[model samples]
Target: MRFSASEGLRTMLTAALVVLLLRWGPQQLVELSRVWGEWSAPQQATAVTYVLVVYVLLRSGRGVQRRVSWHLSAPSATALRAGSALASAAMPSAGGSLSLERRARHEAAHVVGFLASGVVVEEVDVRVRPDGSEGRVVAVDNKGLAPVEQAWGYLVGAVAGNVQDLRDGVHDGGSAVDMNTAQSQVWRVISCGVRPAGYDGPLTADALFEGARARAGEVLEQHRSAHEAVAARLVEYAESDSRVPLSGKDFDDLGVGRVPADV
Candidate 1:
């Protein structure tokens, strides 16, 4: 919601221009009509064609600019592929026997984070696989969020899981995928030219990841009760059927206040 001085000045100038146009627009339009009437049929056609071509070129240029900006900001294909491969490779194996309860808490934390940030979480699921327990929280891609908020959303799952693990005096090993995913998202945010608050270091994924991790931890700690309530509910669902995911409505029915208390 904040704007630089230059932006404020530009907005003021634009408003003034709009007011002037509104005052003089009728007279200008009448003058334009007079000139148009004086033009021959061929001259009118040529002018219309010229205006159309200029409009088309301007629109095409804007579209190309938008596309280039998006490409520059978005994560590269190689980074995405590497993140996926790393997530799969770093998954806990069957030998470790990851508990269903832990997986439930992990996914529940994600749901809490998304809901707190005004993102729409569709479902959360904890599955018991032969290799190990795994969980996922499916959320709508809310592109309207600020970059810092999006980074917090991405990092909160791992931060909350780690906090829980520390509380229980257990070694945490299930958040590799979460961290990997968060790092990639942080990289994308940095590429988009936004830096995390208090970050003055080189523009690297690691720096932003740490900043985002700390902020997510702070926010999750502030809403610890909500997270705990969600986690308990997820555990109850897993007890009945670990495969059945909890819908957004199910979480809403719990009556726990979202982290921000408002969307």
Candidate 2:
């Protein structure tokens, strides 16, 4: 099976640790025997407790992370949510004057995620400061989307897009807000602000994202081609749109608020 560098290093370290302990364990036991009478009962208990704590951390640390995701800041859930929460809002402005390329790509990913027939392209109007900073504001346009598309097809596409946004060599990361409307809510219910299933920890932003991105294999294995087909269509649509071009749109449109790709 294909394994990551981290996994290989982990295995190597574990084996080395085992060997070290094997070599040192007997020597330590002999040393302990030499001092058994000198170590107090409380001191022995403390040593045992430390070993137990370390063991628990080693074995169940992952479980703790997965289970405690709700306690983590919403921004740390994954790159999808981090960018979406900012860019998809009703008013998406950056903390500072943002790059035109970053802005273009951010809009591109969401349009791809939520793309459908007859959707509205709500232009992202950011009021930049002298220093140039802003946040993201996502959109929800169902004005002409068919009701069925709004409920099902758009739903699948949204999940597909969300999963797609994190693949290797996609958009870097950007603040993209959510519109908080029914159409957007339906998609978010299934895709946004959720932790990766395989990882458990007190998630740092890095770990949460790494875990989410690591799902690329599973996501693509099952849904990659389908999502890519849709994203490709989106890129084609954007290329034709007056709004999309140049700066930094590495990969790359919209209709009425709708369901997902399943439809």
Candidate 3:
């Protein structure tokens, strides 16, 4: 019956907003009559408080309902529910096996989508500034890329690759990167450049992982078959590598030439 911190905050904010509008409505009308253009501070504060109270009551009710449903269902189907929940919870730690498999699928999706839509998921390049303090550096180029569905594929791939690298003891030369870093970096860039149709605002890595998490949940809940397919394929891909981390070099080993010509 407890609301999550995020949910609670949202509820409070929503209520505050409702209060603001309510309080402001009358004052705004009065201002119009008086040929004034501003709402009094008290009016604004009252409106916000009213909004916040309403929001909390509604949201808290929903949270209570969900908790009740989960508790009731747990006893009836504990094993299945617990198993699935465990897998979803442990997804962040899936390791080289899970990482490699997801990367392959994501890459394939990117390649396929790009061929049909002129959108790319990954970009690679080598850069040099001869006169600068540092020598030439190889960089994964994601610049000029517009955030799109393809970007999600790339974000998944980057995170998976980095995760696999870490699990297999591969070094990034400087500081070792983690799944969180990859997700954040990739998504932040995408949010800025891709500008997917309706999504707006400064994006964070948390948002990227959340999107994937939600998709995974949907597959498990609404399309078990599809979920199984993805899980099986990921497991298979991981096993194929003997638990080794797949990398830029791995692609060359598999005879997938360097970055695509257009890229």
Which predicted model would earn the best TM-score? 1
lDDT, candidate 2, 19-50, per-residue tens: 34545667665554554455446544544555
How well does candidate 2 score on lDDT at residue 94? Answer: 39
* Clash count in backbone of candidate 3: 13
What's the true lDDT of residue 59 in model 2? 60
Please report, as a residue range, the 10-residue window in candidate 3 with the lowest summed lDDT. 77-86
Q: Which of 1 and 3 is the better model by lDDT?
A: 1
> Candidate 1 clashing pairs?
none
TM-score of 1: 0.54
Q: Would you list the rank order by TM-score, best first?
A: 1, 2, 3
Candidate 3 regions exceeding 4 Å error are 1-149, 156-178, 184-194, 197-212, 219-223, 233-263
What is the alpha-carbon lDDT for the whole of candidate 2? 0.38
TM-score to native of every candidate shown: 0.54, 0.28, 0.25
Query: Which of the predicted structures, 2 or 3, would earn the higher lDDT when compared with the native?
Result: 2
Q: Judge candidate 2 at residue 30 and give its lDDT.
A: 55
Count of clashing residue pairs in every prediction = 0, 59, 13
As for TM-score, the candidate ahead, 1 or 2, is 1
Off by over 4 Å in 2: 1-98, 126-148, 151-165, 168-184, 187-263
